[model samples]
Target: GLKSSHFITPTPIQALAIPPSLARRDVLGSASTGSGKTLAFLVPMLERLYLLKWGPLDGLGAVVISPTRELAVQTFNQLRDVGKYHNFSAGLVIGGKPLKEERDRLSRMNILIATPGRLLQHLDSTVGFESAGVKVLILDEADRLLDLGFLPALRAIVSHFSPGGPNAQNDRQTLLFSATQSQDLAALAKLSLHEPLYINCNKPGEEGVVPAGLEQYYAVVGLEKKLDVLWGFVKSHLKMKGVVFVTSGKQVRFIFETFRRLHPGLPVLHLHGKQKQATRLTIFQRFSSSKSALLICTDVAARGLDFPSVDWVVQLDCPEDVDTYIHRVGRTARYQSQGKALLFLCPSEEEGMLQRWKDKGLEVKKIKIKQSKVGSLHQQMQNFAFKEPEIKYLGQRAFISYMRSVHLQKDKTIFKLSELPAEEFAASMGLPGAPQIKLFETSKANKSRGGVKQPEVEVDVASEEDEDHENVAAQSKVSGPSLKSVRTKYDRMFERKNQSILTPHYNSLIRHSSSASESEEEVFTLTRRDHDLPEFGGSTSGKSRKPLISSEDLSKRKLKAGGSKKGLLKIRSGPDKVIFDESGHPTTFYEAGKEAEDIARDSKLREKYLDEEKERMRKAHEIDREVARDKKRERKRKRKEKEKEVSKGFFFLSYLPPPPQPPPSPLFIQKWAFQFKVFP
Candidate 1:
């Protein structure tokens, strides 16, 4: 099979690591990616199983743990290929697949390949799990696993094969492999390996260097112009197959949309952590087979998946560190193939990291392209007709999954629908209808502001009754008694008395009232009045009453003088004097003569309405709680019933006579007699 597959010569890692691994010795291998490390461990794993004559009934012979689902799938494929001649059975366990389906196939598998998290889930949940018969354990991409915060999961998985664990056995061989060996990997080896043989196949000056066949260059541009530069490059290389690495899933969607719009006929795909496992695998297969293809993705695709004959690797942004940069570029120049890598750098942003790349023995050159050309490309892209991106329109189920993924990525328990840039993001992905987003409020502080406290108000926007009630309350404020009517009533109340009324100071009183009805209303009217009278400016006698100034002039003069001594002259309209107390919170009077009374009334009405609204909300919340509780109970009851059915189906088997016990050895019988004073 090796010869048939063209494995004529061993790679450096293969030659050094294979012999010991085949000998059943634990091996800790460190070699740069694309060094054929997969075969280095895979060949030996198959050879050992073949030598042991392991078969289906022998239980699981080996368990391989990968950091990512893609890698796990890739490794499983390779294992299948190597074990095909031996007729060995293998199975895969990862997320995004039906759990029951995977559980049903466990009994027939001789080798299992899985991601750490998913494998741990099965270890705890799967009944009759064939873990105790495992003979080998392999952790691929050990450093990447640790980098992704999977150390705790990895430890839990390792414990499954330790003493007293489900997979406990004496002949377990552990193999650990990675491109880089960090202190964390060293510590992990202490816990996972037993006096392992250390294999380092890295070249002397190739510690942080990309493959020699990969030609590396970078283009410097402004932050705003990166998309334009990227478009120009992709446009120029439409026929070339390549991968574009971005910093985030959002960027993956953005770049894919931009390019898809510019060249609607071209084959373009995107993969991100948030995508469904099945969708990701489909996209991966499609990209691998397409002759002229583009894959826009995040770091999820950076390490350890074999992509064939890639011509270019474009890093849309500077990678976080050197290892990431190497792995990304390594995706292209695999198996000594010639490839090009272009690093797009924003002006002055990551220049330090670029310098560090040079210092770390990587050969990188800056590729200069005319800014005018980029500008021209940008203009051309603008002129192109906008085509909707080729993203699938999400149904309700997919939309819920999408939202749940976004929330999980943010590590948020509650997410506000209004806060999500849903329309823009959805349109970029060419989703047809706007998502019906629901707002969830959480008790935690705002994470974006470094845990700053924020006030939260929960309202059910879905309730039409609540909305109508709010609308009615607002309308009543507008339609209630006009300020002019209140002023007229005040004038009527005081007009019966003949005593001359003075210029009133309306700023010295607080009036509180409700707008519900006249009977429920309470108003406190305060006015400062003067007893001395001044005539309107013609006759001095009381009957004519025209002595000082016009009514309009007197009013303006009184406003400008504002309770001053000069404005003390009384202007008689109606004849009742109202006095105000001097010691109270001062209120300003506007042109609306009854403004104070109106405001006081509105405040009381609002308070009453708010109380009623609170009661309604409380009732609605209680109903929602009850519904959720009922659903939970229904689900629990169904699960219990299913368990009972399964137990009943196996009741006859349980009642069958237990397998005959084997006769005890003399030593075991003597020990048992000593402990219990009885022996058979």
Candidate 2:
């Protein structure tokens, strides 16, 4: 079957790693992605299982740990195809599925492929999972798994297989596969492997690098012009299959909707962690089979997905790090195929990073843009007819959420809604509420303007008792003949009083309206007049007046005034609180029956409260259970639907009647007799 399927020779990695792995020796393999690494590990694992006569009763012989659920599913499918002739049974355990169902499926499988977090959940919750015979443990994309902050979970899981642990049964063979070898991988090997054999199929000089067939180029663009450049590139390659790598899920949806509207006839797909498992699976299958499609996604599609015939990989923005760049570019040019990668860089910030990459031996060249092509592409995109109604309304929520999340990042190069095009886009999406857009100006511009001054509004602080007096003073000032006349009148009034002659400080204040209209006017107002105070304690006879209270008493009063309302005690009202009753004795009861009724009522109320709380808790539990059950049912339905489709496609071939055999001619019979030396 391998020969018939055109598998004539093994790749370098496969040729080197398969033999040691088949011998049940722990192996740490470091090679770039698409170096035939999957087959290098999978073929040997199957052979070892076959040699052991692995069956359902022998328990699981191998377990593959992947970083992402998509990768795990891909690996599981490949393992099933390779092990079709054997008796090994494989099961997938990942998040977004019912734990109970996964637990049930765990009993009968000989190999399990799972993500670190989900597998740990099962090991901690499911009974008899640790006892399942797992002989060979493989960690795929080990660097990515650790980078995702799964080290603690991975440690907890590996502890179960320790020699002195409760679940330890046999010395397990370990295999670690990664594209790059970092300090983390070195530590991981010491913890997981026992003097493992090291296989570096990437060659001595070109180890830890991208494939040679992949062409790399970058374009330095203005921060605001990235979308324009990306649109041009995507439109230029509209008929070829490609994956556009973005930084976040928000960007994924944004780019997807943008291109989906610009090219409605094109097959555009999106993949991210937020999507449901089944939906992602269906999208993966569709894109794999699509001849010309566009997949806008984040780093989730960076590793382990084998997309066939991908012509190009476009980075919408500069990647966060070198490892990210390599993995993203690795998505294309798989299996020694020719592919191209384009990186969009902002000249002000990313030029340094680009130079660093070049210094590191990456053969990346700058792409010169044609002004006429970009202009024509932009015009074409604007003129394109958008027919999707959902795209018009979908990005508003995502945009708002992304803005809120990055509000504190202090990165000025990030896109802002203050730009005219962005504001229009937001308005078209039907975004609710007034969008708050703040534009950051460059330092050179600020220097040129000699530092722009912001308008200041001063607030006056006054006591509550003086609030009415301040308002009356403000009204009188406004009602005066004129500002100069009012000042003169206030001066005359203060001079006539001659009792310490209090004068108010005047200042001009401007208030701007919050209306969206462009023609709104700013309102200016003068400061309020000050109020006169009375002499202290009305001049006592032949003695100086003293304060009404001491400093200590004043502080105590303030403290009492500022006390919490909840801390105050309230008098209880009930028969139990009645110290004296209507009788001659000190303690006598006039109506004992009323008192008994009150006690009974209180008891009944307490019981009712408890019952209500219990009912609420029960309802909440029921709701959670119902949600889990619904998810399980939805997954089962999708699986059965997929199975039915597959079966129907081949069902006709399976059930078709044999073709009728035609009778042999006389001349053919004579020739047959002559050849066989016999007559029919």
Candidate 3:
């Protein structure tokens, strides 16, 4: 397997550590990252298992525990490559996979590479899964495993193994390896390293160091300028493949989203603890194979993972400690490859972090950012954030996460939250305003590191130089009333920004930083934009702008805007009375408000008169209707009488028809007589 993988001369750590382990002696190896520590321990491990002739029925022959799933998966892949010829059945057991699938095949795995939490969980719960017969144990990143944070889980895992055979010797051959080796590892861990051979290839007393081929540098930038500098750097190095290490998952997500939208001429990806397991693995694989891409991530990707052909490693935020910085840079310049690193430091942290690096024998070149090289993104960012509520929301979350991460830092000397320019940072992210954050933090790390002597009080952040809104003033003079009592973390959490959490340490100190004010909401800005600085910077256009209209038109526009009167009187007469006369016009009732009030005062009398008038009208209407009916009857009678007379005339004419004919013949003679009678 080694020859097929192009194995040549052995590395120094591997050369020394593998031989002792081959002789059945426990080994503790320490070396710089990517100095072939993985293969060093891995070679001995596979050889030991092969020599023992371990089989699938050995009840978990080897257990390798890594701090992260990425590292565990990596070690497993390498194990397969090294042991492909052997008949050892191995399986990876990590979180984010179906428990049933893992349990169904778990008992068959002769070798298991897993994270501590998952391993401990299986030991405590998985049926028929036993590690008592385990023969070998390997801890990758042993320093991380031995830290106080992970010590409890490690102890439980160690307890699952059979007790050391004799004189604290274990049933298994343990191999412990880490880049940062220290005596504190032994102090923190109990009996994990027996009378084992301690191999250290690094310089003694140094925790960690940069690779020989890695060029390290730092830029002392204010928190407000960090984003712009990072943008400028990424813009300048568009074709370079690298990782941007931030403090929190939210920060990673925000940067990834924002930069992706900006289209920085490279593929942008993000990985954090919050992503799904499948998503993380997919992203990890993509980044590893990608030629030119930028990965924004939290510390989840900082340790024990390797990417090929990476050109740069940018630490946008200061690392928690020197060890982290070493490992972060170790991701690049692997196997003697050349790489570059850049760190951003605020002025407050510059002194302390420089001293720390000097103590560790680490060297970094200090460089000033050139204004010509940097692209200011604050205006564009603010515009986008203002338009997209989603971006604004993400900006807020990222802001809070950043503040929380800074507050949670164990090294208070370097990670001073008060020194950060939160409002400026928000503006750089395209946020209209800085999201509010309160740093009332208390943790075991704080106590251990002496970070916050007491839980820090949170008040409206104003300019540190502004005495009017000082934290002391806020506490001393609360809005409503003063309460002389201590509040718990829960109480503090429910406490709104309006309420200030005061402490008994009323030393009346005016602590200030060169950057932003203490809290986010109380940021005190010292300068205004060129457009806003009329008195200071003059007009933004260099020459004053005059209105583009005639004076008369301008006056008309101004008059239209407000306070203009109509030429015609808008004298609104009182609303017409509800009652109307038969002529379809308004009644004569008074509509004046005072007259209506007087009428309302006499409403009882008016109502009585109205009722009497209504009754009288009803009686008069009945009488008129009866008179109309009588007239109608008289007309009908006249019509019937006329019809009867006409009918009688017609009957008389029919009976006297022959006599009329005779009378007509004599009419001519009687005509003269008729004429005389008519004249008479």
Candidate 4:
């Protein structure tokens, strides 16, 4: 056996929560990553199973549900060590695995740990509680499950177990565990538990940002400087497993490519929702096992994942919201281990997020550094000058002709700093505190005075024309597009028609009634034979050729014809009637079948409830065999006394009184009998 000293000490969260959980009380443990929450629940669960003598032969009893497959596997492996002493059979049920294998294993397992979706799939199959006999249920990441919209499935699974009571058969214990208890999660808990005990460890100043183990760092730089600085930071952390969080999938690909090119030997891989589950799992396994220098990913891999050895987390871009920011920083500072976080801020999006972080009382280490000049290969390609060797890159006149063909207009709005060299341009123009240079603003009403006194209106108009031409040339230089694509002054007069009919007014204007007109009655003429015609000419056997053109028929036919055209021709037609229900969705003919099924099921449920009520009332008055056979002792005693009295009288009569005549008076006999009875 490994010594007790081999195990790491408990964190504050573990210290506070493990005891209550071991006593079979509910717990809501809220702490950031690397806070020892995994072991907090694991230790208590293992200890209870150990002391209670729960093993595989007892049938499947304990179930742990996690949000992701990877987290479930990690938790399974963590507890497997302690479970070894008692031969506890723990099975894993997650997606991307065969259902038959999970079902077969669940038939004779002790603890079945699974993700919600896969577990629900098994429940949808033929497997029942009689086989598994599940007793103890644990939701490892309960908040995540609710957030992922698994409440309906969770409720159905919980309903399978009998309600806990003294006479209840197959009563099971439920344990809900989560790092964060959102409102939706709390609502879900109410459905699963029976007045459960609530435990919270997320106290302010103690459970939040002020941790002693992890160090937080921040740097302010331009948007272009982030990747270069992040690459530098990753190169510094040589042996640690670090993760870089970018914003988008495109950014993920870009950063991954850049890192590979910059450092070939670095074991860096990117994981996102766009990748297949198999590919994601493979990358995660490789990254977790190896001493990968960095793992580049997005917010998709942020929550419900465990990486115990992650030493650092670098936020590539400031997240848009506080929750996203929290999830990004949460990757590190996990468990009882130490971690470091580095946040890179761009000039375009720094101030707002920085203030928000500061308001949250985080001692964010802000470092103001000069922006890095190393550009991405993409950016370099965008900025490089191309010189052709053919015909000595073309003579100057030939180049001018080519430029004219391309309509390469010159930027006439000369910047004050444009005269400076490339080296000075970045420092002089790029600095935030640079003084304001001359900026030209066209004055619609200004007139330049003559050299001495007269107002030069013609000169003013000439300067204004020059400015307009300069503005057009500057725009043309920035975007190298064909001149034909540019809008002419004459094109501005007409309003831009909303080419698509997908607007509220599209159906309203079908009759073209916007123009003023007197009331007029609409008329239609219909033929009986045309009424039998099929739509879209699907099938028509011996249909009459005499077409009747009623106004209604004309309108319907035109609408059908319009609907056949694809894309932009589609109309945003409103329903004849609007129906609003509890759920905020438009109820149209499309959902009629589903609504009918729902109504039928509700009626069936009501009938079931009524039957159950009748059954309960009947059972309350039921009498058993033991109660009906019980006799009264007093009745038996009285009967025995009467028989004894009669026997005594008979004995007395047989003794000697038969030969005696009526010799005594009635009063004397009565008195004598009374005396005799009293004496006896």
Q: Point out the higher-scoring one by lDDT: 1 or 4.
A: 1
- Model 2: lDDT to the true structure: 0.69
Models 1 onward score TM values of 0.57, 0.60, 0.67, 0.54
Worst 10 residues of 4 by lDDT: 454-463
Candidate 3 per-residue lDDT, tens place, 268-337, comes to 9999999999999999999999999999998888888988898999999888888889989998998778
Candidate 1 per-residue lDDT, tens place, 252-334, comes to 76556556656635698999999998899999899988999889998899989889999999997667667888889989888
lDDT of each: 0.70, 0.69, 0.77, 0.58
**Candidate 4 lDDT tens digits, 359-405:** 56566787654434333333321222122232122222222222222
Best by TM-score: 3
Ten contiguous residues with the weakest lDDT in model 1:
480-489
Say which candidate scores most in lDDT.
3
Off by over 4 Å in 3: 146-148, 165-170, 182-184, 443-680
TM-score of 3: 0.67
Give the per-residue lDDT digits (tens) of candidate 2, residues 319-364. 6557778889998888889898988775554555656575456768
Worst 10-residue stretch by lDDT in candidate 2?
Answer: 454-463
Assess candidate 2 and give its TM-score to the true structure: 0.60
**TM-score head-to-head 3 vs 4, winner:** 3
Candidates arranged by TM-score, highest first: 3, 2, 1, 4
